[model samples]
Target chain A: MTKNDLEQLIETHGNEIYQFCYHLTGCREDADDLYQETLFKAYEIRKKIDKSDVDSPLLKERNYVLGIAIRLQKNLYRKKSRRKEELLDNEQFEYQTELASDFNTEEKVEKDQILAYLRKIIHSLPLKQRKVIYLFYFADMSVKDIGKLLRIPEGTVKSRLNAAKNALRIKMEEKGYE
Target chain B: MNNEEMIREALKLNIDAPEEINEKVLRNAKHKNQGVVFFKVATLAASFCIMTIVGTGLIVKASTGKRLIEYLRGLIDNRSYVYENGTDTIMTVYDNNGEKWEHVEYLDDEVTMSHPLSENETEYNLYLKVTGENGMEHFMNVTAKVNEGQSSEDLYWAIRGDFYRFFSPYTAADEKSQILAGLKEAADNADKDFIRDALIDVSADLENNRRILYEDWPADIWGGEGRYIFFEDLSDLPVGKCIIIINTVYDDEDSFIFEINIDGNQLYVNDVSFNKYSEEYYQEQLEKNLPIYDLR
Candidate 1:
């Protein structure tokens, strides 16, 4: 919980947490602010984090930091959409305007469409299911890791992931995508 | 790209953070005393507990109460027996606020000129779009399958079961004739008695739900999960093979004609499009079910 420990946590896990926040918010600006907020929040309560498990210090720290980010993201979402019950209002879901790669080719165009559809479906998902999906699929986190980060049972994480997958499949099918 | 691949690609976009994030974190952490930190942590923990308890309560209520059944029914009721070019049909449910509760595409095409539902595979996925209590729409895609495969004798009962699931919560006792007209329109010579019995069951179920819930009969309850219909008589009703033609009538509103051969005779069942069958239609049909149009 010292300043040195905080600096090390940021250096080692900061980018990962940043990625998590970016996917959670689906916007870079929000991610940056949330990333900083999460680090500070984690540092504030660093003394309370269960530190007895010396076998996985980084893992413990990652969970603590990511947990704060997720809660903050939920709070932000609730605040943003308090007037409307829609879980992911269109205004809150801002995608990057520029694609990461060039997409002048036909194949890339198709890929872009599919990816956009995927993003829409992901954003369409309920908050809980969306979190599990982003962490598992986008963040490349293991189900066990996600369960720990979300503070839920691993089985619950698995179920939520399955539900999200099924819902996505149905939506993709609706759009004539197998 | 597949979902995982697409997500990986999306997440791969390097997210830039402000350079001053480190300084901000250090300053905020330094400003927080041990007591303040403890207080914030304690407050967060308490909030989490309250959220969990309230969430669990809502989930339990939704699952066991009207919400779950309404959601389940929305999935099933959106299905229709119609010819698709060997292509899947989809059903999407949306709440009043235009938020989708369920979107189920890739439903197995179970209809042809001859067979409406496959005898081999009774399992069918229904896409439901429902508006939740908050007026936001929810979507669900659920499989409607009975474990035991149904025989032709079970078809009427199955149809009746579906009818009950579809209408009981929505249609009142006085509106029984509308259901009869609709069913009669679907299958000509539909036994008035059989249809009446199903209607009565629906009304009874609605009454029971109203009594138990101690609330007014929610209009949303009509199509949902609680329908498990069983007709005592195992005797098969007479149904003959006849060419059935389905066409939408655009000139006189978006009504549909379900023309079928019944008992070596042509029968016509025409009414408003099932998709548009709403509270307004319920009221309209209360006076007189729409007149049938004969194409044969």
Candidate 2:
């Protein structure tokens, strides 16, 4: 691939790809590493990607990066677990927060609490379940695509997504959120 | 906002990619490109074939055997059934450390009553007292009410509000198809408001929030209740099974030890120790003592 192609891919999908990495690892530090590795891998195999393979440029970009990420994550997880199983169990992850001044006080407070609860719920899910949730909700991927990337069936993807949502519902109910 | 919107909004936390990451990836890519040398076509083709063979072997290895997630998935029973005549449900749970304790829930007679109420419109407040050996007690109150003749689907919706209640003799995916079919009927109608009103009249406790929201509602949204929140037999758990206890609160001062085992088709939590108590002594005492209540 040309320098122009590389720059274009990064400029188009960098934030989204990074967000996927962040949700997968559930820690900013790990997400940074995974994101960097994913970009480098994409660059290495850029020549294999056919620009005209699909109609949507955005979809192609996402597919390329996510495909690399899924494999990288699986390999990294096995290696990490062999050394130490409890990767994120002991460490505390600080979620980045930004206060938007446009909203009124009451609206802002309500929104913030909901966001906090949801974030906590997401963070608490098992790593595999969290990945499915992030791809379905945040990445807006179809079930088929998620299945293909994860090398699982569509039923399994739906099953994991369902489990993640149920876990969230339980947490939310405990906190008095209907 | 609806669930989809709520989810999208909740996932909106701002993430700032580190400046170093961009610098590192581009630098490595440039170096790799510069170091590349022209290779003969025949040599390149040979290398590709060899790499493919090795890659295929690795992929096959990765696909073999049980994955960690699969084992974890089977940990929870898709559906648990308590005898209709039984008034109590008991199970054992385990902590991350493999300690076990018996957990018992005594459902009041009214709660376990299988007979329908005489009145066309009647309600019952199903009361349960769940107590652990660690002196932790939880009171559960589930409202089970019916208007007119009740369908099985309506009964499920009433209990789904509580996760623990939802798991009682849970329905498997295959069994849940009938419920989805029922919901699908409701979805077929073009008048969302009409169906919503009808649903409210039938079972106000129904958990069909998503069904009423979208015309082409996916079945998984409704399938979630049965698909998740299951009870697996303790005997089915692998030997030396351990689980992690996620602390809901930020503070770790009140952490409790939990462990589980299975016997006679009933699950039990054999050990529970509070931080304030002597864990070793407590565990020793538990091994000698019989369950507080042996309904079986």
Candidate 3:
């Protein structure tokens, strides 16, 4: 692609790719990194373009960008088998913003305390469940999409999400947040 | 619970990942390309008989010509396009960290797609083509609303308005689709005007990091029971205020009064977060998405 074409690509599909990365990685910083990696992959492979082969550049780009993102994420996790990294739980994520209200707000204080505990629980989940929880709750990605990224069956992604949700809900209920 | 709803809600969790994932991807892609010298030579040796042709073949012979409605339904539902490797000198930007970004600009050109509104004949088919990202073009067929006895002109404008509604989201004018989705929620609550004309913008106090606009709304627009004020593209709007244009077209105005439910979020947000198909997965999804006919 020439200067003009590359400019057009960025002008057209930049943010869309970023969002895809954001959901896949579960953090703004990670999304940006994945997006950069995906784009660079596309760039190196750009010479193979057969426009007639694909009716829409955006569609082609979406597929390519996402394909790279999934593999990259898997590899990243495999390399980091040491640290016991804690994930952000749905309850804490939901209430993290409402924690600083005035002293008179009894309901708000209770919500804040509950959320703080929820964060602690997420820190204790297994790695796979932790990843599943982030993708579903924070990224809002579809199970089908997650399945594709993980190279797992859609049924698996669906069940993983369901299990993750149930796990969170149960934890919340155990802590009396439901 | 349905897989769709479960998947949708499950996508809202807060997951943590190891840092430096991006750095590894760049190194990986680069390393993979290093071995491309052998991979390319091998693929080239087999390219001729393998794919039959360098491009995807999608020609179907129909005695009665193309079935507009069926063809359209397939395209829209699959969300699959002829996947191609971008053949140009792909100019890409990597923030010092190595993430890809394609900046989107509002190109005012209208993408016109028409299909036969009548199902009785194959000649009346839908043809749709729109301009967006270079390779992934969006194709959709318009359904007939003749049942509602809508005037072609009113239906046209409403659809045109809907096109605006659909495209407005990508242009970062979140109001058109966001309000419509919110109103659909209200319609679920049995609000009569939600469909006819109940779209509104409520982006008042939000500025940074606010994905959806946050604001208060009055009971009605200028006392019109079903009037609507929609935001076309307000990405550049001041944080405290949003811009909106009002539209008040009704079903009675068209002989073919039709109702369309635009999947505005998918159409605009490009939320392919969950879509798992790629050329790598294509050979696999193909077995599932379509069954190959062994004519041999």
In order, what lDDT does every prediction score? 0.44, 0.43, 0.35
TM score of chain A per candidate? 0.75, 0.81, 0.54
> Model 2: how far is B263 from its true place, Å?
59
Model 1 has a DockQ score of 0.13
- Which candidate comes out best when scored by lDDT? 1
Off by over 4 Å in 1: A28-33, A48-56, A85-104, B1-3, B30-296
Q: What tens digits encode model 3's per-residue C-alpha lDDT throughout A15-51?
A: 5556556555545655666666556545434433347
What is the C-alpha lDDT profile of model 1 across B1-296, one tens digit per residue? 56667566644544445558777776656654221221121111111100000111011111112232244422122223211112344333445222323322323322111011222223333222323233332222222333223332233344334433443333343333433343333334223343335335433444443211011111112222222222221112234322221222112332222212223221111111121233553443334333333222
Instruction: Report the lDDT tens digits of candidate 2 across residue range A1-178.
Output: 4445666667777778887777677677778877887776566444334457654765666765876776566445433421323344222233224544555576676766777677767766766677788888888889998886665689989988888888788787898876
Estimate TM-scores for all models: 0.41, 0.43, 0.30
Candidate ordering by lDDT (highest first): 1, 2, 3
Using DockQ as the measure, the top candidate is 2
Question: For model 3, how does the per-residue alpha-carbon lDDT over B1-43 read when each residue is reduced to its tens digit?
Answer: 3433433443433433232543444454454333221111111
- Candidates 2 and 3, the one with greater lDDT: 2
Question: A1-178, model 1: which lDDT tens digit per residue?
Answer: 6667787777777778887787687666667767876776566434333557664677667766677788677545533332333343233243434543564566766766676667767777776788887777766678987875665689989998888888888888899988
Better of 2 and 3 by TM-score: 2
**Top candidate, metric TM-score:** 2
Q: What interface-residue Cα RMSD does candidate 2 give after superposition? A: 18.2
